[model samples]
Target: MKTNRGGGDEALKFSSFFFMPERPRDYLVLFIRFSVIACLVVSVSLVLRATFLSSSPRDYSTTYGLRFTTVPQKSIALSPTGSIGPLNVSHILFCIAGAAETWIDRSQYTSLWWRNSTTRGFVWLDKPVNLPQNHSDVRFSIPIRVSDPGWTRFKFSSSRAAVRIARIIWDSYRLNLPDVRWFVMGDDDTVFFTENLVKVLSKYDHEQMWYIGGNSESVEQDVMHAYDMAFGGGGFAISHPLAARLANAMDGCLQRYFYFYGSDQRIAACVSEIGVPFTEERGFHQLDIKGDPYVYLSAHPLTPLVSLHHLVYLDPMFPNKNPIESLQNLMKPYSLDQNRILQQINCHEGKRQWSISISWGYSIQIYSYFLTAKELTTPLQTFKTWRSSSDGPFVFNTRSLPPDPCQRPVTYFMDGAEDVRFYGTKTRYSVADKNFGLCENNTEHSELTKVKRILVTSMKMDPEYWNKAPRRQCCEVMEGGRGKRKENEMLIRIRKCKSSERI
Candidate 1:
């Protein structure tokens, strides 16, 4: 019993020491240590969350819906040590020309628009002259010489200014500039989105002799140049190999076409002899308007802007009053949305009643002015463009005709038992000829609202339905068929009920 009691005492002594209360200083130290460890753990967790999980910068494309992109544009996979971004454009030599008086304005434009460029700018003057401060280096005086053909016909003459200019400029930089890949030509007043231009050139192999340019603006100009000439003021690019060939032949070739009028035509004629064709690109603006016209640049032209010509006379191209600021504004929305920018819509349920505007990838938004879908009795201007100072180049013009879908350029129509059919085309508006003026014609609603314009025949109706019921064939109508033309075609049309007869 005494030995058992001794063991119990030893146990009690061990328990008493283990359960003793800590002092205030010791307890405070323990709490501080716990708080420090907790703070460290939380700080580390927050740092890890921020580093591993965060949204990236906004994509430059003005996409309004699901941006289904395959990979980053202008991005190249690089080795661990290399950097990647927009392509470098050192291989291109920019050769620009202008008359003596406009050098100052052109130089200012060149500095801003083609800033930080790997370019050699040349301004060809009409006579020997002293240039402004920074302009002396790139400017060259007239009587610009090239190898003469040594004959009167082929020789550069006073009357044929274009021939002389082309021979001198095109030949001057041949083989001498060995390292360059392309020679891009433009007037000093021409403004270029240099980055987009670089990207456009990168797509093609510079080794292949390439001649790329844009077409003339109007039908009259087309008739004059016969659409063969590249509008020179708009700017054009020549690959190294072609430039070499042109340098060799242009002097002799210019002697042949004494009748040619402008520099562009003469250059076009020379190239025609050389057999390198003009690859047309859309971004080049060749003409100046009578007044300030912002629609050409701002209204979503299908191509990326390469250059704009004749900016001096026209109204400013951008929101700002300054021309340099206007030039920079050309890069907005990086790329044009080609697919379904304007959908070919039939006058079905939603389309006819309200206005449906489908902008690029963004979903369709329907705007309805009336409470109920009814015929617009009053003559409402279907399209009108308001030129408010605030609204820049983008006015929703339901008034502008769907600029495409030109059928056979003729006018003829035939009527079937149930519907009227237009064989080819006449005036833009689709209408059944009545004793008086014409009203909304078929499903096409041709000139009605510029929104969704399509002919009745294009609605994917069954061929048999047209043939057997009130029916006849179309494309074949003009060709030949057993069914004679429907003389009474305009008489019968099964149209929807009109709202009111009082008007």
Candidate 2:
């Protein structure tokens, strides 16, 4: 009985050690499942937290507003008769008041508003506290100095003018202003289209963009070429950091260039010297208020945005109806190609020459020529031929022989204008500054010979339809002339040449 009991006990021990009823296994599986579920819950919580943080707006806010000022240099008579006194002061006051009213009215509906306008009492004047002097944060004040009757005569030299403007802007900064992002300085003559401007500013990354303006000058080029950096004083913005830099640089700049002439130029020079990154937006202009279809602004188109300048020409009733409007209206119903041609040609009554000058990239020269109107019209055919021809050394003839490739057709209203001098030359031939004797030649003659060949080839073609013929005729004539014609005949043939060849 004792042996049997002992064996039973051993058997019981072995069963307990090797195969307990799967309860432990169940417990172990449960633990693993619970652990996995806990991990998933934690992971989900973390993901939610991260997403919330990533999507939340920053704690600070950006303040934006328009700042306007005016500088009148001289007075001029408004009417043809000199009986009336100079209207300069009245004109400036009118502009200042208009700008003020417009901004005040617009601000009621928009978040951005002007601090001071003629309609609204000057509230910016109340603030006189100083703030940090750091590069990213600055503060100063501007005293209203235009209280005199002839304030129009108060010409603050460019340097003083810059300082005065800078002081006012610096002083206007709200003390410890949180996240003050940008300050836009504009002339009193400017009218801000806040909605459009805000929409544009929202699209750009403010951190990367600095010194935003209607125009900008390349620092290197402006300094090297002594060209003005395009700071359209009419409308410009500076980021907080740039403003700090400007404040610091102002004194040194004034000392260096004591007699600066152009306000925009001086600002650009200072910014360039300080190595600030600058950007320009298109819709800004300095001189004209006419809105161009292809441009955002009339005179200086910034990047892709459009802004107008010289608000004096802006019609209150028809804001966009100046020259640009007229052109746009005339071409509005036309096809794209027709519109393009019109734009290229300035098809308006007083703007024919305007069109050709822009197309030829000779605006100044064309303007000068246009002033000589009768002489200009006399060369209409010559200009037309020049416009039509692709290659040069244009030729003309007084007495016609074979049709001249260089000969341009002329239309004259005046009678007895036979033997119109059509100018043509082989474009390849460089005009030698040295006087050409009857048979002068030099060691560099080979270059001239090559050019002459190219010119001859360009102008070779049948005379009957010189302007309408294929370009290959020119090549044929140059390569396969029948024989040497008389000098006079060659000259006459050149004179009768027309411009029909395709490029």
Candidate 3:
């Protein structure tokens, strides 16, 4: 064995290279040192694994595949599909600003949109009212909750109600209703298109601070109440986090802004202190104007129509109908296609030199002569400023009616809309008023004059369309794909524009 120990001798030499401890206890010492090293390695591995997990953010995606990153505790905006889900009407808590005196008249307006079970929140009245025992009989969809009497203590130069109204935000936040994401405040007369509102809000993260609303249509009003202020009548939305922060600072904020003229102004001032800026959404119409809203509505912005306020001060939405009745008619088509309601589309037939503009679910304008896409989209100045009744500055561009009525487009108001099942929908528009004069019996005008009704066919717009950048839909006159005359009727189809197509 000693004679043939070639590899064995090398192994022994390698083992003895570290001066061998001669005691048996030395082996135990060596084993303890290796064990300690093993334990430290295992401990380090576990610490690393935990640190990676704790520092890494959880990812959340929306129905549209929008991704948001958040940490463990403050992952507020993440959909609870596993924890929360996409924003729905139930997540929105509407805090309606109302008064006991106006409740009788304004309750009618609230009943129009408010759903008893489907919608959440209450009509916060200045004082408790003698509400009917059987709420269903009265057709009121929202229950009344009297605002805390504590609002009267705030100092204010404006109507004392402004102070109370401003507190609606704090009041709604303090309720601590579970699962609420947004607090929407509006006047009793404000009509909200809740479906479209949900669509708009779905784009924003509810956990983050958002002060969303619209400025007054009248420059005078905006100048008086900071152009950025979200007029309460037009309605505004505050995200859950922002509302909570607002609640904490609100009482002191109210005292500071007591001299403000409007409840909305006071709110804007407080929100400014929190370092949140006003986010103006075109869809929320303060409607700070007097007279017919027809012109303004006819040329709505290329966005979802969210809310309308001051209906009591203006003429009804349609001719030959009162305000409520007109609203009832409008809601008919709105129920059918909410996103398409008041959406404007223009098409021209070259053969007849005819230009047609369609306000889906609202009105139609037809002209024998040609008008550029830009001109047709601009609303006519048929309305005056809210305060002065002057016909000057508006937030958007407006074209004055021609002194000659002949230059104006023949207008048609929506009559009805019907769903076409598997296909789409058909909206009918008929002449409402014969107020505008026709051009002196020209042959081109003759052909247009004979047409009495317009039938619009369109697919129900997906609510997700609002989540992206807005583009006006393109339209084509049916039959010849140009304006073809029918016996007192015209048919048109609306659809998304081709990639290479122009409006």
Candidate 4:
């Protein structure tokens, strides 16, 4: 009875307050305040819901029974205080896989292109090696970093080195280097044409995930491995964001893919788990061949020459020189015009009834007889497969050398190159002193043999040329070519073809 009276009193007070009439102005103000409060509560609830949904993990399942769990995108930590304007030699970090045993011989290949203070990265070695007292040479440009020891703990099939090498991507990312957009991995013997490499990499957005490189040239090797796998010796680039993701997952991935034969395959497998596919840039030459690389290097694809590998297995690029010497000779012209190195251009000298093929910065061939464009472009079958020395099944087409020596063209190797004015270059090619039977009865053959040296003039190829759809530049025999010049000399010019000009 006492509790009922107290409850009744409270109810009566609430009812009186609810029913009490107020001024019209006061009522309007009350309604407005109520509405505003309601709106604020609803707005706050909506904002909290949106934030939670965005930050939380979500599952997207398809009708086909496949499910994908996606998390929020994480922002990458860039060490550069200022904005990275454009990709350059410094923007790339090279993580070279090296061993103490072979470093002495193979280190020369790395030195060939590695710039002392400009290029970034380290030669990751199994163990440290003694250095020469005179370490001032460009050959010692790259500093060495010995890998952490626990790489042997991972289960491996063929070689334990695969585990250590595959972990390079992980170890390199852990360094937390500054302003590194791309991490380029390669074998110690791999030689990179860095200028051309920078040109190719600039085309891609480094902020996004990119795994760019080339596959094996041999179909057998591709079949033995994976067609989509980037051959490591050719060198491959992993963008910053992708490298971070790979590094986080590399230890677990290495444990899972331990049975893979090669380190490249292990890397490919880990990359696949991250859902980034292998992107092929044809300029990366794995050089998966036996015998000679002359014909292959001569007829380069319509792209920038980025890298070359497996030089130790193949014959020297130029005759009468060792492998390193040949590369040094090639590098001289490469330094002059890297974009135009080994770029092919063929033209017909209609008056002399001759066909001329130019592998710029490398070699040139002059034919007394006329040959079709297809015949000139196709690489001669001068190489075999990597694993098996078989003739069939290369990635690209090849043509056999003509059985008749008479049909063969006289060959010339690059002697020297000099800048001609500001915009152009003049590369000289001296006839190689090799004995071959000439087309004896033909007048064109006799006249061509007397021509000893050929001078090629062309505008310096802009590095920006590779950014567009590649079209081979057309060439023409200069006017008064054989008439006004010395009997032992020839001149030619390479230029862009006009809209109506046909090859």
> In lDDT terms, which candidate is top?
4
Better of 2 and 3 by lDDT: 3
lDDT for 370 in candidate 3 is 89
- List where candidate 2 sits over 4 angstroms from the true fold: 1-161, 172-182, 195-205, 212-226, 247-266, 277-282, 288-503
Model 1 agreement with the true structure over 322-376: per-residue lDDT tens digits: 6665444332222221121212121123333433221111112223322121221
How many angstroms is residue 477 displaced in model 4 relative to the true structure, after the best TM-score fit? 1.4
Which candidate, 1 or 4, would have the higher lDDT against the true structure?
4
User: What is the TM-score (0 to 1) of candidate 2?
Assistant: 0.34
- TM-score of each predicted structure versus truth: 0.47, 0.34, 0.82, 0.82
Residue by residue across 1-503, what tens digits does model 4's lDDT show? 88999999999876644454367666666677678979999999999999999898653322222223223334223332122577889888999999988897898889988887788998999988987777787666578999988687899888899899999887787777656789999999899999899999999998789999999999999998999989999999999889878877888898999889999999999899999999999999999999888878888988889999999889888888888998889998888888999999988998877988899999998888898888888887788999998995899999887777667788898989888777788899989843445467767677888878889999989767887777888998876655646677888899997778766
Q: Where does model 3 exceed 4 Å of error?
A: 1-83, 132-134, 480-485
**Candidate 4, position 345, lDDT:** 96
Q: Rank the candidates by lDDT, best first.
A: 4, 3, 1, 2
lDDT of 3 at 427: 95
Clashes of each: 3, 31, 5, 0
The residue-by-residue lDDT of candidate 3 on 1-503, one tens digit each, is: 87559779888766654446578887887687678979999999999999999898655333333333332332223232222678899889999999888897898888889887788988888887776677655445467788888898989885899999898887776666667788999989999999999988888888789999999899998887889788999999999778877877788998898888888888999999999999988999999999888978988989899999899899888889899998999999999999989999988876787888888898998888989899989988888999999996988899988877677778899998999999889999996664666578567777777888888999998767887788999898876334544657888889889999875
lDDT of 2: 0.32
User: Over all chains combined, what TM-score does candidate 1 have?
Assistant: 0.47
Residue 81 in candidate 4 has what lDDT? 18
lDDT (C-alpha, whole model) for all candidates: 0.45, 0.32, 0.84, 0.85
